[model samples]
Target chain A: MRRIISILLLGIIALGITLSLAKIPFGTPKTKVGRYYIDKGVEETGATNIVTSVVVNYRAFDTLGEVTVLFIAAIGLGAVLTTGRRKKPERKIEPASLVLYTGCRFLFPLILLFGAYIFVHGHLTPGGGFQGGAIVASAFVLTYLGCRERRISERGSKLAESLGGLIFVIVGLVGLAVGGYFLMNFLPKGIPNFLFSAGIIPILYIVIGVKVGSELAGIIDNLIEESE
Target chain B: MSFLNHYIYYIGAFGLIFIGLYIVLVKHNLIKVIIGLSIMETGVNLFLISIGYIKGGTAPIFSTPEIEAARMVDPVPQALVLTAIVIGVAVLALALSLAIRLYQHYGTLNLRKIKEQRW
Candidate 1:
């Protein structure tokens, strides 16, 4: 009975969605705002990547709210998972083989470097802080899986998360003070396509990368602790 | 045939969304419901991205000198989806954490077995 009801509801939803969507032609350039951003993005933000310019410049405030939502979720996860611990005896997890351990140790730093590279070159390339941060978190996950005995430093991760958020907010405040608007591009937008260009965009992205990386790592730590 | 060619992406995305919705509604396991939620989010993200496609357009990046701004796909939806994906991840993690808590408290993952979970 429930399955039938669900199917009926879904059918209705699908019908409504399709009927509405069918009017909008496929694979066509729409959205005047998007076109404006594409045309003016390079000049206004000095970033070769229009997506990056839109994300960190035109819609940065939205990004900040998104980051806050992530932070809250991480905190909520920790709170929910850690409450009223059962105090069960810790189950022993078998250590990885010597070869696996050595390989993971060797690759860890390289993965971190690659993640850092992605966020640092966000303005010039397709990758950005969020992608880079996920990569960094994956590196943490790798370490967790490969090294059974090792644990990430809780204090250090928390500190990095806080500091990253602080940097973002401070940069925005500084922009407001200097440019008379919040999140304004107060600093000089250097030459396009260079590592040093895009002013606050790259800087904010790096901050976001660190914040997201630490938050995800912390979430992983909390879940691991729960299962442990 | 032409209709199919034109609306295939929309059809595919909506198919995912419907499947996700069915899973969320009919599944008895709490974890399955959360997984469904994630799948629905994926469909939504895919739909947002598809809305930005320009048939023969390139990405919105200026990777080369010859890539014209007029020929690029919309950047807005891409930007929106980027953050949405991260937010979705966050929400999924939170929901899973809640599931873990519920399992710990009730000692069961089946929504049907949980007395208060009856629809």
Candidate 2:
């Protein structure tokens, strides 16, 4: 009976959504602003990657809000899980196989390096801070899975998260002071297609990378500890 | 055939969305519901990305000088989706954590069996 009702409800909703979606033709250029970004993004942001420019330059305030949202979620997870917890006896965890443990230990630093590469080259490449940060977090997750006995330092992750958030806000405030607008591109935008180019963009992205990386690792830590 | 070609992406995206909705509405397990939510998020992300597609467009990045501005897809939606995807991850983790609390408190994973969650 429940399945029947849900299917009926979903069918109606899907019909409505599809009917509305049909009017918007697929595979067509839309949004005038998108065109503007494509034409002038390189010159304005000094970043060859237009998506990075849009994320870190054009709509930076929105990104800040998004980062805040992520932070709140991480905090909330910690709060929800830690509150009123009855201490259950620790469950014995079998050690991971030697092969698996050695592999994770070997690959962990390499994964961190790759994530750093992604965020640092965000202005000139396809990836940016968020993707890079997630990659970094995955490195932590890999460690958790392979090295069951090892616990991440909660204090260190929190410190990195706080520092990253501080730097982002500080940079924005500096822009506001110098350029009279929050998150303004106050620094010199060097030649495009270079690592050192795009001024505050790479700086902000690196900050975001660290922030997201630590926040996610913290969330994973909370969950893992709770499960254990 | 032409009609199918034009609407395939939409159909696929909406199909996933509907499937996720079904799981969320009908599934009894809290973890399954969270998984359903994640699936729905993936579907919505797909829909958003499809909205920015052009028939013969390349990515918005100018990795090479030869790539033309006129031939690139919309950057705005891609940027929005990037943030959305990360936010989705955060939400999923949070939801899973809540599920863990629910299981711990109730000692079972079933929605029907949990006294507080009974409909």
Candidate 3:
């Protein structure tokens, strides 16, 4: 009965959505705002990647809020999982295979480097802070799976997370002080396609990368600790 | 055939959305519900991305000097989806953590068995 009711509800929703969406034709330029951003974004931001400019330059305040939401989720997860923790009986665990351990040890630093490179070159390339941060966090996950005995330093991860957020806010504050608006791109818009170009965008993305990477890694750490 | 060509993406995206919603509404397992939520999010993200699609359009990046802004797809929705993906992950993690707490307290993941959780 429950399943039937739910299916009926979904069917009605599907019908309504299909009817409405049929009017909005696919594969068309629909929004003037998007067009404006595309046309003016390069000259205004000096970033080769228009998405980066949109994310870190034009809509930076929203990005900051998104980061804060991620931070809150991480903190909430940690709090939820860590509270009322009791001692668990230690179970004997087999060591990981030598091949697995060696591979993880070799690959971890390389992944971290690639993640940093992604965020650092965000303004010039298709990638940015969030993608890079996810990549970095994946490295941590790899470590957890392969290197069973190793643990991330709780203090260190927290510190990095806090510092990342602090730097983002400080940069925004600096921009506000200099340009009269928060998160203003007050720095020089250098030559396009260059690494040092795009003013404060690269800086903000890097800070976001660090903050997001650490926060995600911390969340992973909490969940893994809880299960084991 | 022309209808399929035109509305294929919309069909696929909405199919996933409906499936997810159905799972969420009908599934009793907490983990399954969470999985359903994830599928729904993925569907929504796809829908948003497809909304910005331009026929024969390139990515909205000026990586080369010859790349024309006129030929590039919309950057706005892509940017929105970028943040949305991150936020989705955060929400998923939080939900899973709550599920963990629920399991720990009740010793079962079934919504029907848990008195407080049952509607």
**Clashes per candidate, residues 3 or more apart or on different chains:** 0, 0, 0
Of the two candidates 1 and 2, the one with more favorable lDDT, higher being better, is: 2
lDDT of 1 by residue, A1-228 (tens): 888988898889888988887788889988999999989998899999999999999989999999999999999998887766567676788899999899999999999999999999999999999999999999999999897788899999999999998998999999899988889988788888888888899999999999999998888888888565
lDDT of 1 by residue, B30-96 (tens): 9999989888988988888999999999999987888998889999999999988888888888888
What tens digits encode model 3's per-residue C-alpha lDDT throughout A8-88? 988888899888887878899999999999999989999989999999989999999999999999989988888665787
In model 3, where do residues sit more than 4 Å from their true spots? A85-93
Relative to the unseen true structure, what is the C-alpha lDDT of residue B107 in candidate 3, on a scale of 0 to 100? 99
Lowest lDDT 10-mer window, candidate 3 chain A?
Answer: A84-93
Listed in order, the DockQ scores are 0.87, 0.89, 0.89
Which pairs, if any, clash in model 2? none
The candidate, 2 or 3, that scores higher on TM-score is 3
Predicted candidate 3 versus true structure: per-residue lDDT over B71-106, tens digit per residue: 899999999999999999988999999999999899
Which TM-score value belongs to model 1?
0.97
Residue A144 in model 3: lDDT: 91
Better of 1 and 2 by TM-score: 1
Question: Where in model 2 is the C-alpha error above 4 Å?
Answer: A83-93
Tell me the docking grade of candidate 2. Answer: high
